[model samples]
Target chain A: MGVIFLHTLNRMRGTMLGWGLSLAGVAILFMTFFEDIATQADTLKRLMQSYPPEVLALFGAIQDLSTPQGFLGMYFFSSMPLILGIFAVLAGSGLLLQDEEEGVLDLLLAHPIDRAQLFLGRLLGMMVVTAGILAIAFAGIALSTQWAGIDTAIVELAKSFITLYVQLFFLSAFSLMLSLLMPGRSTAAMTSGLLLFVAYFINSLSSEVESLRQAARFTPMHYYQGAQAIGEPLDWGSLLGLLGLGLVFLAVAWWRWRARDIRITGEGAWSWRGLLVRSRGSSA
Target chain B: MRSIEGNAKTLDDPMQIPAIEIKGLTKSYGRVQALRGVDLEVRQVEIFGFLGPNGAGKTTAIRCMLDLIRPDGGELRVLGMDPRRQSVEVRERTGYLPGELSLYPNLTARGMLRLLNSLRRHRADPATIESLAERLALDLDTPIKNLSKGNKQKAGLLQALMHRPELLILDEPTLGLDPLMQKEVLQILREARAAGTTVFFSSHNISEVEEVADRVGIIRKGRVVEVLEPESLWDRSLRRVRVRFRKAVDPQRVAEAPGVTLLDGSDGTSVVLQVTGEMGGLIRVLAQLPVRDLETERPTLEEIFLALYRNDEED
Candidate 1:
């Protein structure tokens, strides 16, 4: 477990560097708006003068971008979760699925570790690294706000960052589940991409599409985006729902992975037991 | 054809139980059968050679025994433990060099060894590993991606041997090595055996197996066709004799000689004989040939392996 976690952490170092740069860029952009809210507010109003409320709502759905708290919400809450959420999915899928693709899983499984321990160890490590990335982004946002002389509740801002990072936990689980179900890395990557895009579309279109509004309840993003624990009372119900979805996806992924016949370089022939098991169940 | 269970003297008789035992092991990918009722055994402390052509299920059997892949139907025990149920224990005592020597590309040779050492959770003396590396002429500071195939193989050998496990399971261990390095690996295996380590390895190289293996198992179409001691095998299989007569010899007379399967007779001066059972009868015939030159050759391991595979193909 320690070996797997260390390796996962090592892999995330590169991705974390990218996240740091992005957060730094966003923080610089937020710094530009700190000096004068009235002028910025006027510019935003003028910018939205010709656009419809739906379009402005897409742009302004979170909070007024005039105050530090609102600006933090716009910069960190509105963008970081989505950016880091995708990053988490891509990273998590590659972590375990690449072993299968490379066929190293065979050599690894020959060792003493159990399947459950390996899964949980890798998942925990990935979660820790992801949490670390979000924390760095949070630190970047806080410093930028303070340097700009903006007054905001640190506790409230911290809560919002936590909510955003928690969204990534759900995405990592969902992407990992997709990785185990697909046979090849390319197929797994495409499936994770489709899941992420579909989830995003579902969350965005929920308000516009009458039929999808209630259907969005099944999507994790709906709960994560709606949790909005900052600048408001914490929504325990949505938080619990997101947590439950994450656990369920992880369980399904574990079940799928336990039985996977990992081939190195994808060169080995198929196993008949897999066919027997599939025949006993659904085709999938 | 020998039942590992029926051979119960394994408990009391040191030679009765093989160090490695596999029975009725069957595996398939979709419609392709990788192994079908494959059974094999290796006596304790003996150098057992598994010889097979590509796609002949040698790797599959090894993987199953290592518990890397769960077999569909089989019972496997290595060093008296079920590999699937006790993989960690098996791995702890077994040194394995995979067919493909792939390590973390970003890690240097030393880093790769350190990582494996950490995973094995054993105290691998740096000095010992360094000496092995130096002896193999492998560079320790170079990243694995930058190393040539031979160097990568050397790195893998270091990882497998540094821990000094009791059993060495090497798959094509000499791949990418210079002839000298190949000889070095063979000597290392011999040294390990002398130290009481049971060595189970697979190879396509016939001479290497003939040089080291105490017993050889030939597999074809995922089944063991023959397992025999080299001396005994050479004794049983057919022999070749080339006789150049001083003058023209009678072909019919030579054909009537016992145990001589006539291969060819040209110009009445030279003759080839496939001696099936013994050289006793052929030697008797050659005494009367007034031979100018004579040579006798035994069937090589290569021929035996090819014959086994070709027979499988015919079947």
Candidate 2:
């Protein structure tokens, strides 16, 4: 298990470096404009008020445009989940499926290690990589806050990044589980990507569109802190619930993969029709 | 044909357990049955060759023994342990080379091997790996994606032999090698057997198996049709003889000879006969005829294999 974990981490070093630098660069870019936005705060506030309520609802009620939290929240934090979620979904779905599709999993599984150990080792490795990238991005945000002389507590920034980390972890876990049940990695990634978009839109539009309010509660986006974490206390119930759901998905993926047949490349793609037919025949 | 069960009981040490024992094993993919009641026993410390043509369930049976694929019914034991219940232990003592080998293309051969070695309880000796690579003529620094098919096959063989397991199961181990490398691989297998490793390999190459395997098992249509010594196959294979007589003679004389069949008597001076086993009887019969010239052709291993399968179907 330790060997597999270490090997997984080593293999993912390139992904860590690439995504890490890109996210940090984006954070720095976002921070540089904070002072300019603050100087025109009065003019922008009047301009924002002139727009319809529906338009304002999309960015989430801008309470105080002049504050650093409000400025960052409106522009940066609103799209952070979707930005990080792309990496999460792709990595989670590809972690095992890539090897399986490339035909290397059979050789790896032939070793003395059991399936459970391999699953958990790779999962832990991915979680660490996710955390590492998030930390790099946070460091950029912190250094930029000091440079710009923004008045926000460092602890509050840490809290917001923690919420972001948990959100990305949950999406990753969900995608991993779907990869086992779906036909292939692309299908799993596409489904998860579509769900992420839909959830974000539903949650963002719920304030203005009353009909979507109830459905918005069911999406993972509903529990996300977004800009709220920068000023308010942490929401323990939502944080823990997302964390617990991620565990459940991980557990289910492990159960299915332990006994599932590791397929050869180009043998056949697993599909719902084939599964259902087999199920019916067995039941009959 | 000698039965595997009978051979198992006649081993030098009666108390010695077989390296692999499969009973009434069966597997299916959707509607296609891959294995049907496959019963085989491979004794310890011998080179056992499994011979079967394409789609004959050779890979499927090998996969079941290693617990790579679950059998629909029946039982399998590897190294005296149940594969399903103690798979990790079974794997710990066994080394396998998959039929279609796949490796991490991004990693160099050395790096990939190190990763595999780390998975086992006892790591392979670096000296042993270096020697195996030298013997196989494989470049350790080359990435797998850059290696040729034959080189990739050499890499696969090195990993399987590096750990020195008690039992080795290789499926088509020499598929893409040059003739010289194939011979080298056979020598390696012989050396492994000398060190008391039970070698169970599957291949459709008859002469290769005939040269190295102590015993050979023939599988057809998901069943073990025969298990016998390789020498026995040579004994049963047919040989063709053609003779030119100095004068006209009756073809019936040669037809009545033991193990000889008169295939052609078109001209008055020539006769063609197919002989099975020894040619002693035909030679004696020919001495009486007015012979001028004689020629004979040996049967190929492929022809012998087809004959065996055809005989099995007849039975």
Candidate 3:
């Protein structure tokens, strides 16, 4: 665990700091306009109604513009998924592939650690870093809301933040598992990043395209559902589904990782266990 | 085979447990075979050299011992424990240095060592690390990126040696080092073996392997083709002999000489023969003629290595 976290943090601290600070910066930048927007809430709401439902859905359809939750839900929550999803994809692919690609995995593996333990350690380290970034975002938004003199429901805000985090957690894990199946780092990162964008688009356009509503169910972004957390109870079913999917992805990642041969120049031949596991109808 | 200079006990103890043992180990890539039934055994406290050219599966065999890569078929034991089933136990007792040493660019040498040391089942001694750093003339405070390639390699060596495990598996251990440092590293390996630490190191340089290895396992095309002592190879040294007869003698008589193979370009002026053993037969044949000047040249290590392969091919 120490080796995994130390090595992961050594490699990833800069990326984490950059993403976390910039995300919080973006959230803070959006919040500065909150006070000015609150004054023209009625007019802004009418303007939003004039746009197509697709645009409204993309922005997480706001019912009451005067409230802080509605204002944040419209801009911040709507766009945060894309930012968080991109970070997740990068982190997921980089964590597993960095050592091998950089020619460091063999040296690290020379230590007294098993494949399963190493996999768990790296996965946990990525999880902790992702959580830390979202925690900062949550704090930044909360402070910005308070400074803007809006009385948002604290419980609702916390629940929304938790739900948003869970969605990204699952998305990043699924991407990580997807990366395990890829041959190269850049290919994995690009593939997972493209998947994130596609999912975001499908989830957003589901409102306008009736046929896509069913399709959105498969997109990871569909489970975020943070826009409505303040008005009603949090979606436990969707949250559980996301959690379940995250576990499945992680398990698959482990299943494949346990048997994969790592190399410095490039990938090695597929292991016998990898083939055996695949033939037994496990993760590919 | 024990070293010519090794302690008598290692050679005397027929019941001694082998430090590493692999029987008919086999591994293959999708279409390209990487290892083809490799069989080798290195006894405790012996310095075993794994010699092969590039892409000859030396690194693959080392990786299998560490459980970093699984073998397709074989029974492999390190310290009498199965590498696949008791990997952690095997790893805890064995220290490995990869052929390509890559350290974290951001971490200081000390930081990297400390992190790696933290993973040891029996924690590595910090004093051991310091002593090694001092001996190697390495800066522990410098970030890995700031260190030169040779400096980084020194740090890599320090991490593997600091723990003082029962067995050390090093792949191309002296790569990317200056000649002076290379000699010092070999001395360190020799000292480790003298201290009863089993050292299993690999290299393509025949002289380096001959300098320190107790027994050498020659690998070619993913198989251990031969295992022999350096002294034996030295004894069988193929010599190129030149002879000039004062008077014209029968070329057939010199060409068909025992323990000698007449090389091309052997004309009346000078006859060149590749002699593998004692020069008694060649000397007797040359004595019969009016010999003027005689010359003998020994084959280089590389030539001898190639000769071994060439002999194997013919067989």
Candidate 3: stretches off by over 4 Å? A49-57, A267-284, B1-15, B237-306, B311-315
Off by over 4 Å in 1: A36-38, A52-62, A265-284, B1-17, B232-306, B309-314
Candidate 2 global lDDT: 0.85
**What DockQ does candidate 3 have relative to the true complex?**
0.65
Q: Model 3 over residues B41-140: C-alpha lDDT tens digits?
A: 9989889999888888898999999988889998898888898888888888788888888888888999888878888844777767777788788999
Encode model 3's per-residue lDDT on A55-110: one tens digit a residue. Answer: 78777656576777777788777777897888888888877777888888888787
DockQ of each: 0.34, 0.57, 0.65
> Which residue pairs in candidate 2 collide?
none
Of the two candidates 2 and 3, the one with more favorable lDDT, higher being better, is 2
What candidate 2 gets wrong by more than 4 Å, as runs, is A45-65, A265-269, A272-284, B1-15, B237-306, B311-315
| Per-residue lDDT of model 2, residues A1-284, tens digit only | 89888988898888888888888888789789878878888888899899997788777776666787787678767788888899999999988888888878888888898888889899989999999888888888889888888888989988888888899999999999999888888989999999998998888889889999999999887898867898799999999999999999988888778767777743435576778998999999
lDDT of 3 at A80: 77
- Top candidate by lDDT: 2
- In model 3, state the lDDT of residue A193: 89
Interface RMSD of 2: 1.3
Winner by lDDT between candidate 2 and candidate 1: 2
Query: What i-RMS does every model get?
Result: 2.4, 1.3, 1.4
